[model samples]
Target chain A: MFKALSVREPQPACADVEALSETPVETLLELIDKAQQPPWVGMRAASCLIQGHADAVQDTLVDWVQQEDSRGFAILVLNQIDTLPQPVAIAVATQALAGPYASDATSRIAKSTNPALLALVP
Target chain B: MFRLPFALVALILLPGCELLTGLLNGGSGMLETRTSSVQSQDGIATIDVDVSGESAFQLTATSGQLLAVEAVNAPDGSQPLYWDDWSGVNSLTSAVWLEGKDTVLNWPVRQADGNLSDGTWTVDVAVVDDQGYYTDDQVDVVLKLKDDSDLSTGTVNARIVYADGLKQDSVVTAGVQDAVTRWAEIWAPYGINLETSYEDSSFSTDQPFPGEGSEQAEVSSGANGSEITVLITETIDGSTDYYGIAGGIPGTLDYTDHALVIVSWLTNAGGDGEFSDDDIRLFGETLAHEVGHYMGLFHPVETTFDYWDALDDTDDCGGQSACESALGDNLMFPYPVCDWTSCTPQDQLTSQQAGVNQRYTGTL
Candidate 1:
C-alpha cells in the first residue's frame, strides 16, 4: 500500500532559521532555479535560503526578481528579510509592486511600521 | 345494573359463548390476537400490527421511539409520536379509538439507546372501555442488525489533468493521493471514510487556472461519476493566481461534484529542493479545503458577510477583513498555512462540521 501523505519532518523554512544558516548558497541557488518545476522542493529551499542568507545573497535575489518563474518567491524573500539595506529593500518592493505580486507587495508595504518603508507605500 | 347483567351473562356463557356475547360483556374485545413483525428500511424498523375491538386502545413500546404512527382505516391519518411519563414508556404511545372494527396500526421504530441490536422486542396494547374496564395484549417483534460500516464512507475520484505544456509525474500523482487519503484519516473518527482513486490526463487549455469551462470539460470526461472529481492542474490562468478554487455547496452546479486545485501553486509555494513533509501536508490541506467547500462548508465568519460557512462551533472571524486575527488556525479559515508538524484542534473539523460533511448528498 502507498504511504499516506504525512507531516513527519520538521516544519519547512519557517521553523529553524538557525539550521538554514548552515545550508550552502550554491545549493540554495539551485533550489531557486527550479522553483517553477514540480514537487515544490525549490520553493522550500528558497524559503530557507531567503530566511537565512537574505543579506548575503542580495545580487542573486535581484536576479531572481527579474525572471517570471522566480519573481514571486524572490519578492517574498526580500520582503521577509529585515537586515537587507533599506535602498535595496525599497527597490525590490518597487519592482514587486509593478509585477504580479502587486497586491501582496502593497499589503506588506502598507503594514510596515518602518518610517522609511512606510513612506513608499503610495 | 349494567355490571350485574354483564356478570350474569358471563357466568351463564362460561362454557359456550357466542362472539356477540363476548362483545356485549366486553370480555373479548380483542377480535384478533396481537401479533407484530418488523420490517426495516434505511436503518429504521416499521412495526405492523392488527388490533380489533369496540373500545379505545393504547399501544406502548418497550425500548425504542415510534418515529411514525399511521392508522390503516384512514391511511392519511398519521400522528407524530410522543412519549408519556410511564416508567417503561421508552418509546411512544398511541391512544386510538376503534369504531367497533378491526384496524391495523403501523409504528416506525428507532433505537433510543443509539445502539443497533438484533433480537426480539415487545409492544403492549391495552383495550379500555368508557367505564375503565380493560384487557391487555402483547406482541413480539424481531429486528435484524444492519451493517453500519458504510454509513458515512465515500469516494473521491481524483483526476490529475495537467496543462498542455506540463509533463505528468508519478511522484505528483502519488502525492495527490496521499493528501486525499490523509484527509480521510483525519475525518475517520467522525465516521467519514474517504476512498480515493487517481488518474493522469491532460487538457489543451493554455490558461494555467481552470475556469468554469475547465470544470465543465472535466465533468464531461466522466471523471468519477457521482463521486467527487478533483482536477489538479499545473497552473491556473497564470502562475500568480490562487492555489485553488472550489465550487460552493455540492449541488449548486449542473455537474454537482467537482473541484479544481492547482498543483503548480503547491510547487511554487515550496522553495525546498525536494518535496518535503510540509510540502505534502500543504498540498493535502489545500485539497481538503476545496473538498470542504464541496461538502457544504463555508468560512467561519461572524459578521454580515456573505461567505460565512454558517457553523456555530467554528471560530467566527468578524468578517473577511478581520479573518487574519480571528480565524487563527481553523481548518476552514480562508487562507490556512500548513507549516506545522502535526494538526491542531483548530485544523480539524468541529463536531458540527463533521456532521455536515457526513450529511453531504454529493458524496453519497
Candidate 2:
C-alpha cells in the first residue's frame, strides 16, 4: 500500500517532508490518502488551518536538523487529538513508531549503537 | 460591505442581553455580510453570514464563553454559512458536520447561571483546505443578563510538557529540546502548555566510543494529566559486530493518553548521515512530529484506511525520482528520504497542532 508519514501534527508533518530524505525500509512506514489533501500537508493540517497551506508546508520542510539526537523515532498524527484524552495518544504513537525499528537501514547502521554516528553529524 | 435592513441589524445585535447571543465566527478579515431579521419561535437567533466553503468556525462572546460553530445549509437548501441558537441551544460541542455538503453552522448555548454570559474569546478554527494551517478569529461579546456554568464560574487552563530525551547543552540534545519548545509555542492556543526542564542530562547510557548517543521520550497522562520525559544517552563505539547493538541510544517512544507505542532510533554515522541539517529545523520537526504519534495521529498518505484514493495520483514526496515520487515533495508526504546533502523539502505541521499551541501558550 502507499502512505505518507510525518512527525508531530499536520501543521509541520516532518515525516512527509523528510520522506525524500528518508532511507527506504523494507517494512512500510505509512499509506497515502485523500482526506490528507494537497498530499504535501497531512490530514492534521488539512482539517484545521486553511491559510497559506503551501507556505506552511514549505516552511516546515525548509527547516531540517543538522544536529540530531538519535534516540527515539518520530510519528505523524493525522487526526483531531483535542477531544481525545492525551494519554491515549502518547501510548498509541510509542507502539506504532517502535514497530518499525529494526527493518530500516538506520536501524542496521545503529546496531552497534556507535558513538561515531554523533561525530558523523554535520 | 453588503448591508441589510436597519431593523435586521438591530434584531441581531439588540438582544445583547438574550439567553444566547453572539456571532457565529469573527470576521475573517477575509469577507463580511450583515443582516437583521425574523428571530422566529425556534427561540434561536439566525445571523446570515457571508462565506462559501465549510470547515469549522469558533466564536467568543464578550463573556469569554466559547461558541462552537459549523457551516451548514439553510432550510431553503441554499446552504448557509452561519446560524445562531439563542434559546434551546445546548453545548456547542454537540455539533457534527458531514463533508461534501453545503450548510450553515448552528451553535449557541445558555449557561445554567441564568444571567447572560459574555467575555473576550479567541476562536480556534480550521479552514480545512489543503494544508489546514491553524487560523483564529477573536471577538468580544456583552450579555444583557449574566448566566453562568451554575457555580457562576469560568476559566480554562492547560499544560505543556516537553518530550523527554536531550539535555540542555549537547548539540543534538539541545537541538532536540529547542525544537520541541518551538513546537509547544505553535500549539499553545489549543490550551496546551509547553514545559521543558532545560536541565543538562542524557538519555543514552552507553554510547559507542565514537558514535552519537540515543534518547527516548515517554508520555504519560492521568488525573495528574500528561507529561513527556526525554531520555538522552551516553556515548558508544561502532567497531563491533554488524548485529551487536550497544548501550542505549536516542530512541523515541510515543503512547496515547496510553494507547500504542512507537519506538524510533536516530543517528549520524557512515552511509550518508541523515541526521544533521543546515539548521536545527529537522530536530524541531522531529519533536513535534513524534509527539503527534503519541497523540494518536497517523500518516497523511495513509495506506491503511484507503484515505488516498482520490488524490492527485502522484507520489508522496511530489518529486521526480522514486524516493521523491513515492513520498511526494511534502514533509508529511509518506516516505523518509535519507541523503547526506538533502532534507524534507515540503514539511510543515498540521493545522490542528497550530490550534493546540495557540489555545494555551498564546504563541506560534
DockQ of each: 0.07, 0.04
Question: Could you say which candidate leads in lDDT?
Answer: 1
Question: For model 2, what is the error of residue B255's alpha carbon versus the real structure, in angstroms, after optimal superposition?
Answer: 10
Cα lDDT tens digits, model 2, B12-108, are 2334423333222111211112222222112122333222332112221211112223333333443222323311211112222211111112122
Summing lDDT over every window of 10 consecutive residues in candidate 1 chain B, give the lowest-scoring window.
B3-12
Scanning candidate 2 chain B in windows of ten residues, the lowest lDDT window is B2-11
TM-score of chain B of each: 0.48, 0.33
lDDT of each: 0.41, 0.27
lDDT for residue B46 in candidate 2, whole number 0-100: 32
The candidate maximizing DockQ is: 1
Off by over 4 Å in 2: A1-122, B1-169, B181-195, B199-224, B232-275, B303-331, B337-340, B350-364
Q: After superposition, how far is residue A114 of candidate 2 from its true place, in Å?
A: 18
